[model samples]
Target: MSKKLAVVTGATGGIGAEIAKQLAQNGWRCLLVGRNETALETLRKSLGEGHEIIVEDLQDERAMAAIAVRADALGGTALLVNNAGLNQMLPFENTPSSMILNQLCVNLVAPMRLTQALLAQLKRTHGTVVNIGSAFGAIGYPYQSIYCASKFGLRGFTEALSRELDGEVQVKYLAPRATDTKINDMKVRAMNEALGNKMDSPELVANEFMTLLNSSARRRAIGFPEKFFARLNGVFPELVDSAIIKQLKTIKSFLGTKESSL
Candidate 1:
């Protein structure tokens, strides 16, 4: 049998790197995609022979073509993990238009384009598309409107695309809540302290994702209270809204002083 090929974006980051490592260890020939050449090379070496690396900015128009060329060279791609994302916590009014555009390009548009480019190979293998989303995608949060919007769009796109595929391909949305990644150290630490809990490790989330990949599960919401909150928000919007408003006050207090304008 031919070896399964899996492509993972943001493979230099904590979660993405773990996912790539797990996939490679689990008998799949992994393709690591990220902008960090040094990190990508390091990961590739760690993953051993047969693993490949492609360094390209996901926001670049040529990124899809680069991915396609790599896929062709790999013989075919069986799984595509769209895990690259960007987030910033700031008042909406203060957020620059350029930042918003960058967020959209990285978080939403890149995945869409990459998926479209790899559809044929995936269809041939009856492969899967794993979209790494967030809890904020399911519910809105203060100071993260643009980030939430991007995730929500990704979630919606995954749901609709899955239905459209009708089993020709598998689609899964993995939502991990407030992970202890280096991306937002201070903020995450503050939130954890305030909530009296620790942030989930990227490795733990990666393990859950690997399990889901081997199962028939179409969607997974990771984390304890966050998952519960997401479901609650879905069932009772008003209650969820009230709770978030109260939580926002606490978060604001933690942040110290609220800005009148963006």
Candidate 2:
């Protein structure tokens, strides 16, 4: 019996990298996938022998197919972490079509496609699929419209699939709130600070992800007020809308958009 394999996307840096390292530490052989070969290789070496690197962009269908092929060859892939994501904080009016498409592709489409590709193997191994989501997935923020849509779609996909494949395979959604990662630009960081939103380190997210794997829970949303707000928004969105409305001016200031135009 060999070690169970875990295919982790976005293993190059930040939360993804931390998750990969933590998985390796927990005795799982990881298939580190990312566009940066150098970073992936460095991470793979640090993780030691059995782990491998797949240098491919998730946005490219050919690259994704290649990843499925490699995973098939590797055999026992008991876990798939769709952790790769793209985020940008901008007013919807200022957002270009390309940015919207790119965010959707990386955040939602790639995860769906990659998961579909590996469904057969996962079923054979009775594996788990963990989709990394965000607090905004549940409570839509003003400037993060497209990001919220992508994560919301992911949460729905995970929920439906958890029921869809209950006995055969496990499906889980892990939502982390305002994680401190390079994914958040300086402006976004400043906005978070101004809003007094607490940011969790990448290691904290990795640990929470590990806990999710060991537990039987189907979904776990990190943070205190964020998790509370996520549930609140689901039951009473109007209340959340009113609260966000109060902070709308502060949020808008971070958008870097002109006041007159908005």
Candidate 3:
């Protein structure tokens, strides 16, 4: 019998790479998908064996198609982690048209396309789909309109798909708040620091995320106030709105001169 396979997008760094290592340790064949070939090779070499590297941009129209063909050749994928996403720190008004489009394409569209391609294989194996979302997806934050939109869309996709596939396949949404990764830019980091927002390490996030994937939970948000805030905001929008309004000044202090979209 062939080993079960797990596909992790953005596998060259941070939580994506950490998740790949964890899955490999769990006796699963890993497909390291990323845009950087050199970084992908470096990570692949560090991992033991039964791992394959797929260097491709998640934004590419053909990437998911190529992945589908590759997964079939590798004896089918038992797990799919849509971890490839980009973050920007500009205010809405300052956000460029191109950046907004790119963020939408990478963070939201790519995951949908990739999952669509793997649905057949996932159904055959009772496989799991994990969408890496964000705390912003739950609570909209300043200077992250585009990022928040993408994550929110991802969360919705994961929830709808989970019900749509119910007994056929397992779908999970794992949201992490303010992860300490390269995904955070200098200004973004400064804002988090100033605001006293919590940041989780990539490894820590990956471990917790993996645990949820292995369980029966459908969706989980990481971090303290973040998780609490997400729920509170849902039931009491005015409460969250007032709290966020108070932090607007502090959050905006870290923004670059050009960013003023809020």
* Top candidate by TM-score: 2
Error of 3 at 45 (Å): 1.1
Question: Total clashing residue pairs per candidate?
Answer: 2, 0, 1
Alpha-carbon deviation at 262 in model 1, angstroms: 13
Better of 1 and 3 by TM-score: 3
Residue 111 miss distance in model 2 (angstroms):
0.5
lDDT score for residue 64 of model 2: 72
Rank ordering of all candidates by lDDT, starting from the highest: 2, 3, 1
| Higher-ranked by lDDT: 1 or 3 | 3
Candidate 2 lDDT at 155 equals 96
**lDDT tens per residue, model 1, 86-191:** 9878778779999999999999999999999999999998999999999889989887889999999999999999889977999889998888887665865787
Estimate TM-scores for all models.
Answer: 0.95, 0.97, 0.96
Error of 1 at 256 (Å): 4.2
**Whose TM-score is higher: candidate 1's or candidate 2's?**
2
Off by over 4 Å in 2: 260-262
